[model samples]
Target: MSSTAPDQPSPARTPQARAGHALADAVREVEHHVAAAGWDAPVRVFALVRTQAALAAEPGLADQLTPDVLAAARADDWHLTSVEQEGLPAAEDLEQLLAALSWPDAVDGVAVTVERVVLPPEAEEALPADPAEALEQLLTHPQRQDVRLAVGVLRTGATWCALRTRAHDADDAVAQGADLVPGLVAAVRATLD
Candidate 1:
C-alpha cells in the first residue's frame, strides 16, 4: 500500500524536513497554550530557545518543569522552549511591534499570537476610508470572522502557522501549515534576521 519508492526515501524522512516537522509541533503547542487563555487577549510574544540551552543556562528550571518536559528537552537536540515576553510597550499594530524586535543570540526563534477581525473580500470593498471608521466597520461587518493567528519562525528559516477562527473555536478546529499566514510569517522571520 506504500506509494513511495523504496530506494529513494520520502522527503519527510530527510533531516531538514524532520526539523520542520518538529518546529510545527512546537508552534502548535504554543498555539494551544495561548488558546487555553480564551479569546480577546492582547498580542503576546514568545522567544523560542533550545530547551537544552535553557536547562544549561538555568538548571533550576529543571525543578519547575514536569518530568515529561525534561525528557522531551533531552530527547530532541532542537527542542524549543517558548518564553513569553511580558510588559511589552504599546504599538500601533502588530507589524509595528514586530518591527521593533530583535532577538539576542541565545534565542533560537520567535512566535506571536494575536487576534484579528477579518472580513470577506466582498465586505472589504465597501469599508469606510477613515481608519477609525474602517475598524468599526470591520468590527460590525456582517461577514466578519474573528481569528486568532499564531506564527512562529526559527533562525534556521523553518516556519509554521496556526489559525483558529472564533466561530470554530476548538483545538481540533485549528488549521496548521507552514504558510497559513505568509505575511505574518514573514514579519516574524524578519525579527530573526
Candidate 2:
C-alpha cells in the first residue's frame, strides 16, 4: 500500500511557512513545560529589553552566547524595550503596536514576554485560599482572579517561554530558569536584525 494519498498535495514551504512552523515548535516547547507545570496561571505580558547596565548586570547570558550580542548592543547603543501588559494583544493590535514601538537600530531582537501558570505536582488548582477575601476582592476588581502557575510566552512565533508562578503556594523552581527558550529568543534577534 502507498503511504501517500495520490489526490493530496503537500503544503508549500515558504519563509513565512517556515517561520510559522518554527513558531509551532516554539509553542509546543512552551506547552510541554506548561503541561508539566500547572495550567491555572494568569496570562501576563512583559517587554524584553537589554541595556548596557542590564547586560553588565547579567553577564551570565553574555558569557553563554558566542560573538557576544551584548557587546554589539554596547557598541551600537541598542536595547530591546519591554512593556508589561495583562493578557495578550490581538494579532491586529499586536502588529500595530509593534509598528509603533521604538526599537534601537542595533538591538538583538524584539520579543514579547508572557507568563504561564503552573501548580505543584500534588497541589490542586487553588481557589481563593479565603473565600470571603476572594469574594471581596472579586467585588472590587473588574474580573475574578487567582492563578497559581504562569508561563511567559513572548510574541515571537519562534519562541516559547515558561516561568513558574510568583504567586504564593507555588514552587520557586517553576518561577525560575528560562534558558530553555533561547532558540526562539535567538531567532527573534535574527529576525529583528
Candidate 3:
C-alpha cells in the first residue's frame, strides 16, 4: 500500500503557493552563505538576512544596497547598517552575539549608517555591565541628544563600528538589543540546520 495519506490535499499552486515559493527563495539565498562560508559560521548569513530585513523595512535602502556594497560586506564576512546608529535595534544584542561567536579582534566591522533609529529600550537596559556603562556615558554626554550604533563582524578577524546622532532612550536601546540578537542568531542557525 502507498504510504501517502489519502486525506491530505496536494500542494496548492496559487498565490499562497507563491508564499512557499518566497520562502524557498529565501532559503536559496541563505544557502548561498552556507556554500560560501561553512555552515558553522552563522554570522555571515545572519548579517545578510538582517540587512535584507532592514532594507525591506525601510524603503529606499534597497536602492542603496549595490552589488559592490554587498560584495564588500561578504568579503569582510560581516556587514551592518541602519537608519541611524544610536537607536538601531539589536546593536547590543549583535555585539553580544558576536562576542559569543568569538568574532575576531577586528572582525565584524559595521560601516553602513542610518539616522533616527534607536535600540529597543529593554535591550539597552540588559547590556552587560561594562558596555552598558560606556553606553551610558555616551548617552549622558551633554553634547549629544541621540546616537546610532552599527557594527559588523567579519571572518577575517576585523570589526567595524559606527554611530550616528539622534534622540533615543538608553533603556529602549537595551531592550531592542535583548529582543533582536537572540532571534537573529536563532534564525541563522535554523537556516543552516
Candidate 4:
C-alpha cells in the first residue's frame, strides 16, 4: 500500500534541491557500515560541480553557452574537488576551504560530500594507553564510540544536506532525514552563496 495520499501532487524540486536530497540519502545508506568500525575512522568526500569553462570545452555543450555571461571562466577552471581525507583543506581546515568556494554565473549548482569523525572528542581519551588493554576496555563498556560520518551537500542559493551518523532522528528537520553535522553544513552553504 502507498503511504502518500493519492490526491496530493508531488511537489516540484529544483535541480540543486534534488541533488542535495539525493546526496543526503546516499549518506544515510552508508552510515551503518562506517560506524561498525571503532572510533575516529576517516572517510573521504568530494564535490561534483559544473562551470562555464567546462561547458565551453565540450563541443556538444558549447551550443548552449552565452559567451557574455560566462566570460570570466577559463577552460581550465574546475569546481568539482575532493572535500577532505585526500590530504586537503576540506578536512584540515573547512572554514578556509568554504571561503574559497563559489559558483560562477554559468554554474547551475554544486554537490559535495564530507567524511569525518562522528564520535565526540571525549571518546578518544577513554581509550586505554596500553594497546593490549584497549580492546578489553571497549569490549567491556561497549560505549559504541568511533563513528565516521559522511555528509553530502547540494546548493545554488538554496541548500540541502545529507549526512550519515550514529545519531539519526527522522522526525527532526535538523536531521533532514539525511543527517546533520551542524558547522560543516553551514560552512559549505556559505561558500556556495
Residue pairs clashing, model 1: none
Better of 2 and 4 by lDDT: 4
Per-residue lDDT of candidate 4, residues 1-193 (tens digit): 6555687534534444554544444444334334445345543445444444455456555455466424523432322222222444553455566676665544434434444433345765878899779656654554453334344455544444554344442323224443355666666666556
Q: Per-model C-alpha lDDT, please?
A: 0.89, 0.41, 0.36, 0.46
Please give each candidate's TM-score. 0.90, 0.26, 0.24, 0.41
lDDT of 3 at 185: 30
* TM-score of structure candidate 2: 0.26
Backbone collisions counted per model = 0, 22, 45, 2
Runs with alpha carbons beyond 4 Å of true place in candidate 4:
1-45, 50-92, 106-112, 119-144, 157-179
Query: Predictions ranked by TM-score, top down?
Result: 1, 4, 2, 3
| Model number with the top lDDT | 1
- Tens-place lDDT digits, model 1, residues 31-116: 99999999999999999988889999999989988899889889877878889998786789898999989989999898899999
Ranking according to lDDT, highest score first? 1, 4, 2, 3
Kindly report which residue stretches of model 3 are placed more than 4 angstroms away from their true locations once superposed: 1-13, 39-56, 65-193
Model 1 whole-model lDDT (C-alpha atoms): 0.89
Clashing pairs in 4: 24-162, 39-146
How well does model 4 score by local distance difference test? 0.46
